[model samples]
Target: MICALTGVFPVTQARAQQAPLPEGARIVVPGHGWGHGRGMGQWGAKGLADQGKTYTQILSTYYPGTTLGARASTEDIRVLLETSSDVIASSDQPFTARWSNNSIIATSDATYRYFKETWDGTNYHGGSIHVYRGAIEAHQGGSSINSINVLTMQQYLYGVVPRESPASWPAEELKAQAVAARTYAARRKDSSRAAGSSYDICVTTSCQSYGGYGTKSSPTSSVTVLESSSTNSALDATAGKVLMYNGSPILAEYSSSTGGYTAASSLPYQKAVPDPTDSVSPHHDWTASMTVSEIEARWPSIGRLIDLTVTQRNGYGGWGGRVLQMNIIGTKGTTTLTGYGFMNAFAWPGRSNGLQGNWFTPLYWRGVLQSAPSAVTMYAGESKTISVRITNTGTASWPVGGNVHLATNSASSFATSTWISSTRPASVARNATDPTKSSVGPGQVAEFHVPLSAANMPPGNYSQRFALIADNQSVTSLAFTVGIQVLVPWVSEAPNLLTNASFEPSTYAWR
Candidate 1:
């Protein structure tokens, strides 16, 4: 196995090669830790518990001289942690609850130690605490609320607001002790304390892992260095404190004993670029073409065909972590057209890192057809009936409880064409995916019967356009063109010098 940088070899070892380090040269410390020496030492904690140190003693040793008590009363607290977008409805307690404060603390009884606390600003609210003794659990709240409302390692670090418990914390005020412990470890974010601080990654393969055994965890055994401090230091040490790795911030990682790693780059919340490997980020720019033949071939008989080709720097944009809309341009000789849509791919541009980019067009609506006549023919005054078939080909389906519309070119048709069938679709038949007719699947067809108007249309090579607009999916302009022509009469000379003419109707009108 080998690791390299800039074509320069660094770490390498052959399966049968002799170890190369000198007698005293150690690449890594023999001790089983790569982080701070305080609080929950992880590996060290396991070792300690193996030697039989109780969890209560473990907490006391880390916090030093602190009292454990019950949670205070319950009142809602507005919590804002890590600048996250989610807001959870929570409460605060003076002794037992958790709260969001620059500084505060509280504790619970040893018997009910397993606890979790979250706070907004005002009060400290707490939940069941989970702690371990030796191989056995000292406190397992399970579904019971009887457990003490003590702060977990996280709550203790973030700081909690303390208030009066339902019963007075008469003996040793739990809140004050929690605050003192929090402040002790709070300044680790300062650059000057890099040696003492550590970074914590999101709880995934993107981060460092805690290689502990089994499901039950000792509260003291699982403590880890906070992310804020470590990430900031790495960022500060970078050329301009703007950490970079191959021209981008080096993402920090945290691993759970379970599997894989999770990572987070050192970018500010404002205008921060997405992780390079993120499916939503743009690694390179590329262009795609939808050929003219492709569209024309899809539907023939239309003389004018337009095709659009798009060129984009990269495929990254949109909400719900999707690609940006791509603008397409179609040009046929002197005619040009433009449209917007998206694309899906198995990978991104630039690198060959095996990440798949699944892109597709957003939802489209079905268009309805409306015209004066249902059908038309190339004739002068011959009344004919034709059925107009319309299809909803939008990416989305149509509404079940809403009416599909059909209109005639006549301005007074709205009042006179009340007899036209434009009833709301049956609600029972609505698709479960969408209640609104916001989507219309491809090839789903709808039809309407219309009467052809032959009297007003002067059949002399005339044509009219029918338009269709989808209810909620998308708006489309459809032209159903039918050509019509009127036949001319023939005149002949009769006896007595009088001119007689006769007109004969023909079924076919030649243009």
Candidate 2:
């Protein structure tokens, strides 16, 4: 298996050196690991091999309960090399190919530019071959042709192991891959072809990849042939070994990398485990960026994207396991999708932004629904209670901890004597009538009644800015600016307050 899906999806958000996506900024995902996070991690195997672990140790670490044993038989395996097309192929030396029409073409030293021709329906499994110890067979389907490579297990692996793993990796790593690949291949009832198809596996990521013989890549000089010497030697060393469970070969699955930890799997043997060595993999850490427009474009029913939140995780490795399901919040409606469903929807090939794996936390754009007294005249040295209603719009709940409060921005010089500091004005306060409203969750509203006074400074026309703060971080989209008129105290009368955002010209008498 080139990529096997493990438990689910999940994420732990990061910031600072890796900053959070600003509200309404293009959505960016800081992610960890790659693949489905199942079974043996190839890069991890290499790292462990470099650390002096043997092939058996690497296998044991990944497939915990499986036993290593020799294969029951070394039957030939069929690999689907090309599908739905005309196949033109030849070998290094003398080789013969039988078409579906029972026609035979024999050639020698052909450069393998390939002799392309239309298909005639007669399938041949056993033909003649001297190159790579394999033969090419073409099958006729309803409307398309499927080209398959027929070869013995050893010859099959010669073209397989190197494509699945790096040919230059340490001997133990290559050997471990070879064994895993062999077991996986042996367990293949068939490739994703319809039942009773002619092939056992495929040369795509859908299955283990294969570099077919008779290509420029699979060159032969009568002395050396194809990809890697180290990988071939590893194949030879681990000849018929397979990972067996209950005395039968287990469907050994392996992926490129598992970030820091492997994800859980439905199969008991493919358990979640720490992969400390996989830091060497390039995909161990990654970040993918997609825009709000792109998301709404793909999932149009989700009108304007408001929030992308991962709800449940598998509870295994990184990101609190893997993401199981997520809610896509939008102005028009909401849509829930599994991790794979979301990835398949938003990210894909042929696009610049492709979400590599499901192991990620999506940080989205957010803005507050603020309802506050905008136009106001305050008496200097006199404080009055004002109400500001804040609707929680982000994915997280707004806690009432003193850490989450209303604060002044750095540029604000209109400080009032009642403020906690030059920066902080007041903490999130509850409605006295509703004492149970301790914290504000998503979509809920919280009321802030803070003392906004025109005090301790020269009273003049002033512009001031304040922001909703959480744990010392300013919520940028929640920041709002206001203009105020500060007059000298006038007979202790209450100041004029307006509910709407528009400010009106004030003609007031000063004491």
Candidate 3:
């Protein structure tokens, strides 16, 4: 749940009115899940494995309607290792460097040097050298150059699987990871080439974590090399295997965890699904808080802070649902932010360590009566237009069909028709243009106007309340009250016809 960290106030309205939020009130938000909440959840897979589910079952659950398919192993993939003007190419044993222009260049044993252009094939210490297959191309980047490794798809998976999922994980889980990573890599290979890049994918998180040769060395450093036997075995087991949908390699997107339910996506395979095992993940649930001042600092247009509400959600059906849209309400105006935008807004330091995922509950007041009709005295049988400005200060959007009407109180002294009885109920309309028709979204205000007629009212003062209604239910928290005084039109005594005549004792006695 997301809670605004504004200053505390009394529980009762009267006391809350006496103690207002101090200057610079804050908003605190807490949330759940992690990553993009898409595709195969690593932790969920682990959970399934722990529950004795096979790798095939786990894959089928995450990637619905996908089938295991075989692809040609002949197609090679290009991976961008490093980008720099100078690249150190070395090997333990002497190797031949064949240039792109069909030039043969021999390298000294155990030495690193820079090469200007492309090479036909650089073989080092047999297959002991873990650079890449095919040829290594040194493409010129802006003011520098990039070192690309063109190799078979299988060789690329050897560097990717271990980094994406732990090599020590269950053999089935590792196999699942290998297949998914392979499928993902294959789909991106062609697209990357079409984009006019030297490599099919990068050796970073932008594509997938790829550590060449030894898994022990970092992507940035080319040091000691180490390989995990388990990961290598998984790669061999799933060689040339990929997840395919409609006879094509699917975009197999995977994340660390999905909390409990996967996110909704346009892809049919990425639909929302419940994973009971995701709870075992560390980032299954998390929370963060921030001040109103901090949020306002990021989005000053929100003006004086009021409340936050969730306007729309995806079809995932999780708590707070996967936030699709949100409304940030302030005294000056309201700002509508998409779920992703709202998460980015609180990405500031000490605000919310950033929203883990779009799934989170917005915990705050739903609406506020910013302006209400003042107490007025009107003659019995007269009419007055009573209007109130109500702002949607919650996390949810107020749809077009929602309504706002007077509250019911059978014990009230005043009769129901004493005020406005004709417009018994009113719908929440757009704050601007055609309030009677348009809908009031989150952070937006709706003005409810009712023509109050004192038709059969007695000479007395009365107080009435109104509330916002949605789904045929009254939003009691948003209810507001208005005051009215009805008076008789005439007095019993008649006025004397003596014009401009004054009587004694400073009292105007007319005769």
Q: What is the C-alpha RMSD of each candidate to the true structure, in Å?
A: 24.3, 11.3, 15.4
Give the candidate number with the greatest TM-score. Answer: 2
Q: What is residue 153's positional error in candidate 1, in angstroms?
A: 6.4
Each candidate structure's TM-score, on Cα atoms with residue i matched to residue i, is 0.25, 0.67, 0.61
In model 2, which regions exceed 4 Å deviation?
Answer: 1-23, 72-74, 99-133, 189-195, 217-226, 348-353, 365-479, 486-511
CA lDDT for candidate 1: 0.28
**In model 1, which runs have C-alpha deviations exceeding 4 angstroms?**
1-361, 366-385, 390-393, 398-440, 444-448, 451-462, 484-511
lDDT by residue for model 1 over 463-510, one digit each (tens)?
A: 544444333222343435544444433233343332354546756333
Q: What clash count goes with each model?
A: 55, 7, 19
**Local accuracy of candidate 2 as per-residue lDDT tens digits, 29-96:** 76767788788999999999999999999999999998988863466887877686665665545666
Q: Give a tens-digit lDDT track for model 3, residues 161-265.
A: 888988888988998999999999989986777797767888888789987765213234464544478998988888888999998889999988787887757
By TM-score, the better pick of 2 and 3 is 2
lDDT score for residue 296 of model 3: 71
List per-prediction Cα lDDT, in the order shown: 0.28, 0.70, 0.68
Once all C-alphas are superposed, what RMSD does model 1 give against the true structure?
A: 24.3
